[model samples]
Structures are given as structure tokens and as C-alpha cells.
Target: MANSTTLSTGKTFAWGGGKSPFSVSYGKLMMWIFLLSDAFTFSSLLIAYGFIRYSYQAPIANTIIKPLQHVGENFVEEMKKAGLFVQDHWPAPELVFNHFPFIHGMHLPLFFVSLMTFILIFSSVTMVLAVEAGHRMKKDEVANYMLLTIIGGAAFLGCQAWEWATFIHEGARLDYNPFGPRSFAALFFIVTGFHGFHVFSGVVLNVIIYLNVLAGTYEDRGHYEMVEKVGLYWHFVDLVWVFVFTFFYLI
Candidate 1:
């Protein structure tokens, strides 16, 4: 027998076993738990990065190069000479991440990364649209939005790969960092790499869900809860990137 109580309005409320007080499905609840754990991990990494970054001297001011200004191949050396890239001082993110694809030798601080962030946030929007379509049982709409979301995720990943390659070409390795401190490169790789992996996983999950949608799996199941579940994961990935961008690039 379940317990029952009377409210002030004389309505009876039953306490049933197997009911979620939060009004979410079990799967959704579990996903929330997993996201919470993942958030803690990212937070710890960012906190450590912040501690180490501030422990060093502040980044030197950049007065020589303006946006779109031409720079020679010895950009790193020039920055070093300018006292902007030193072991004791944290490297300015703008100086370190100024390169853009097909627009080399020009100083464009944070441009590419900002574009990447936009792509990710746009993907999250598409995911939301897909979930909304799912609620309406609009199979075609859901499929289209899912496809767009996947494309956005893939584009962001490509941008990240390019950024990583450029960094490595500039002599930024896990053990060696020409930027400022070795820990800078290492932490960058660890934190961004971890987040990138999560994005990749989310993309893969999105693909699977997309395929299932095309196959009428959700329609056959009589609900689109799967899409909503995967949407939860995808949104979590996008939210994590916001923090990563803020911590690594902004502050």
C-alpha cells in the first residue's frame, strides 16, 4: 500500500514507489548525473589551469601587431623578442592563437576560435530544434535538424584539428611549449582534447540517432525519447565548450 496525504485544498497526494519526484525519466535522470560528474571534471581542470596561469606573471601587452597586420615567418621569435612569450609570463591567448586558415602571416586574434565557438553554439540550436520536432512527431523535421547538427559538429571538429595542427607546427607539444610555459601547451591539449573527444562522441551519438530517425525507429517506438536523450548529451557537450573557451581563450 502506498502512503497518501491530504493537502490544504483537500486533494489527496499519493506517494508511489517508482515515481520520480523531479518529473524526469530514469534515463534523463541518469544523463543528468553523468553530466554533473563530467562538469566537475572540467571544472577541476579549469581551476587548476587558472591557478597555474595566475601564478606566473601577467601576459605582456602587444602593441606592435594590429588585427590583419602582416607578420613574417619569424612571428614566434618576434614575440619572444618583444617579451610577450617568456617562461615566467603567461602567453597572451591572442598572440598564441592568431593564425587563421588561408589567411596566414596576418594577426587576427581569437578569430578562428570565435568562429569555432559559433559553430558549436549553432549546432546546439539545431539540436534543440530537432528535439522540438521530435515532440511534435515530425520525423522529417527532426531528421533535417539532426543532419544540420551533425554537420555543425563536424565543422567545429575540423576547425579544432586545424588549430591543433597549427599549434604543433609552431612548436607546441605536450612536453615543449614555445608559447610561455610547458604546462600551457599540456593543459591546452588535455582540456581541449578532452572536450573535443566529448564533442566527437556527441557527434557519433547524433549520427546514430539520426540514422534511427531515418529508419523510423522512433516512430515505431511510439515516442522520440531517444532523440531527447541524445539531445541532452549534445547540449551538455556544447555547454562544456563554452566553459573551455572562456577558461583557455578568454581568461
Candidate 2:
């Protein structure tokens, strides 16, 4: 016999445990579990980065130039002369990531990366709007928002590729770094590459879901839970980027 409990109004409820106690679907629950594990992985990577970065001496201050100041092609050599880009000290992120598309020889510290961050955060917003449209069973709205989200993600990827190209052109490599320590370039590549891969995967998934929405698949299924699930993944990716930005750029 199953156990039962009486409510205050004298209604009886059985403790037969076939259903989820948390009232969540098995698929959603599994997605949560996977996200939890992924969170642990990202946490481990960031923690490792933090440990290694703190082990090095603090970054040297830049007192010579201000933003928008014209710099010569020998900027890296100059920074080296100023002791700002030495193996013994961490490179200041502003000096390392100052270039922008179509802009040359100007000290625009952190400007491009800030734009990338904005693009990603805006995509996350579109994702939320998409999920909300899904809740209302508005297929067209969901598709539109999803498309915007995909475009935003693609733009971010393109920016990242450009940034990587610029860094490589300036002589950043796994084994060699003109910046500070070799580990700096290596870790930057590893962490940002990993995050970029996730963004790419999320974009692919969004495309598939968008197509399914156009085909009325979720409409036939009478729910938009798939969109919600993918939204969870997308939001997680965005949140991880926040931490990565803080650690890599702001710190």
C-alpha cells in the first residue's frame, strides 16, 4: 500500500512516486545535469587561469600613451622597451587588445573587446525573447528572434577570428608570445577558443530549432520546451563569457 497524507481541507494525496517530485520533465532535468557538469569544467579552467596569472608579477603600468594616440608600427618593441611586455610580468590587457577594424596605429584600449561583449550580451537578450515567444506558441516571433540571435552569434565569431588574426600577426603563438609570458598567449587561445567553439555549437543548434519552427514541428507537439532547453544552453554560454571577459580582459 502507498503512503498517503491528508491536507488541511481533508483532501488525501498518495505518495506513489512514479512522477518527478520537482515536476520537471526528464529531458529538462538531464539538460540541467549536463549544464552542471559543463559549469564545473569552465570553473576549473578559469580557476587554473587565475592561479597561473597570480603567480606572475603584476602588470606594469602604461604612463606613456593615452587612448586614440597615434602609435608607430614598432608598438610592441616600444612596450618592451618600457618594460610593459616582459616575461616576468603579466601584460596589461588594454595594451594587448586595442586594435579595431579599419582603425590603425591608435591606442584604443579595450574598445574592440567591449564591442564583442556587447554583441554577445545582446544575443542573449534575443534568445530570451525567443524563448518567451515560444512560451506563447508564436512561431513567427520565435523564428525571427532566433534568426537575430544567430546573426549576433555569427558576428561575435567573426570578431573573435579577426582578433585572433591580429594577435597572430603581431606574433602571438602557443610556444612564443611577444606580449608577456608564453603562458599568457597559450591560455588566452585555449580559453577563448573553447568558448568560441561553444558559441558556434549554440548557433548551429539555434539554426536547427529555427528550421523546425518554420516546419511547425513544435506546433504539432503542442509545446516549445525544445526552445526553452536550447535557451538554457545559450544563456549558459553567455554567462560563461562574462566570467571569461572579466578574467581575461578586465582583471
Question: Quick one: how many clashes does candidate 1 have?
Answer: 0
lDDT of 2 at 145: 97
Q: How many clashes in candidate 2?
A: 0
lDDT of 1 by residue, 94-197 (tens): 99999899996899999999999999999999999999999999999999999999999999999999999999999999999998888999999999999999
Tens-digit per-residue lDDT, 134-188, candidate 2: 9899999999999999999999999999999999999999889999888999999
Taking all chains together, the TM-score of candidate 2 against the true structure is: 0.94
Error of 2 at 94 (Å): 0.5
Q: In model 1, which residue pairs have backbone atoms overlapping below 3 Å?
A: none
Q: Judge candidate 1 at residue 34 and give its lDDT.
A: 93
Model 1 TM-score on a 0 to 1 scale: 0.94
Candidate 1 off by > 4 Å: 1-15
| Span of ten consecutive residues with least summed lDDT in model 1 | 11-20
Candidate number achieving the greatest TM-score relative to the actual structure:
1
